[model samples]
Target: MAGALDALWSQYTWALGNGDPRTDSWLLVHSPIPVTLLFVCYLLLVVAGPAVMRCREPLRLVGPLAAYNLGLVVLSGYIFYEMASVCWWCLFSKAIELLDTVFFVLRKKQEQITFLHVYHHSTMLFNWWAGVKFVPGGQAFFVGMLNALVHVFMYLYYGLACLGPRVRCHLWWKRHLTTLQLGQFVAIAVHSSYNLFAECPFPDGFNMAVLLYSLSLILLFLNFYYQTYLKGKQDKLT
Candidate 1:
């Protein structure tokens, strides 16, 4: 058992390398077990963390939450600019971004930690792992750039909201955040679909995965928008 595990680890680690000695260090993250374990823990937390807090009061992690969001804003920006140029840096940044849900779990904001949220965060780890392993450059980097731009604005909004009721007045467009997310998915789907016909060097499998994934997010987020915003507004009027 131990030998088999060691062999698996070695294979995944070696495969993560891009044949560049300068960045071979970053390939250490490709250890399949650790990455799988991390996501498994995250999934368990998504299921049990909220239930554990069910009887408890919601936590007010005002300062920590603000810092977390701001950190992501910076990290996303870094990934946006360096994704194609420095694949490891962007991959590392995205690995850190997965921690956002940990904040939600800690704050007992389980309601905010919806399935879509968990699914998105958790899957990105694996998806980006494949990306870093296979097609880590070229037009493949566009999605990360778009996602980073959106996250910069999104996290900036969350950071402001964490400041307290004083900032609520400026946050009138909270609903628009979801709209922006939907727009992002639409853009990703369109962006990915272009590869189907265009002569891009990126792999067909990865492009198909991106297109299908974006389409799924579009449908899911659209449902969330309707139920949370549109339907709620109608309920209030009637």
Candidate 2:
């Protein structure tokens, strides 16, 4: 067993060594161990956090929530600006986004933690891990750039929502946010699909993975949109 484990570790290290040298020394990209552990901890928190909060009152986090969302808005904008130079920040943003789930659990907003929410948050880290590891730039940067831009507006909307009822009432573009997200996914799918037929320097496998992932998100978001907007409107009318 010990010898087998040693060989497995050696093979993992060899694979890591073959990844992009530019990102090899960057944080969380040196080895899969750190990111894997982080992912596991996130899952554990998702499972355990609600239980811990079950007995406690939902903490009112008005101030902190506002700050957090606005901060992310700034960070997302900055990532968009700097995406051309660095890709690791995009990967790191995925880890930061786990905080969204944490906030949901703290507020006892269990309904907000849907399968699409958790799956999108959790899987992005690993997918971008492979992205940042092997194909750090190229076609992948387009997806990151577009995502960061969308997040800037997304977080801004959430931050404004935390201001008060007055501010939220004025925020009439809520449904449009989902529309924007769907648009982003569509744009990414088209961009990634283009690479599939073209002679791109980036890996075809990565493009295909992204194309498929974007399609999955489109379906999931469409379901969410229908349930949240269309069905709710119809129910109200009846």
Provide TM-scores for the models: 0.85, 0.93
Error of 1 at 120 (Å): 0.6
Task: Report the Cα lDDT for residue 65, model 2.
Answer: 91
- Which residue pairs show backbone clashes in model 2? none
Task: Report the number of the highest-lDDT candidate.
Answer: 2
Runs of candidate 1 with Cα error greater than 4 angstroms are: 1-24
Q: Please, what are the lDDT tens digits per residue for candidate 1 over residues 1-238? A: 9999999878766765543344434553444555688788888888888788778887888998889889888887787776677665565665687777777877777678887888888888877666665666766678878888888889999889989999968799888888888999899899889988899877777789999999989988988988887997898999
lDDT of 2 by residue, 32-150 (tens): 88888989998998899999999999977989999999998988999899897768988888999899999999999989988999899999999889899888888888999999999
Error of 2 at 26 (Å): 0.5
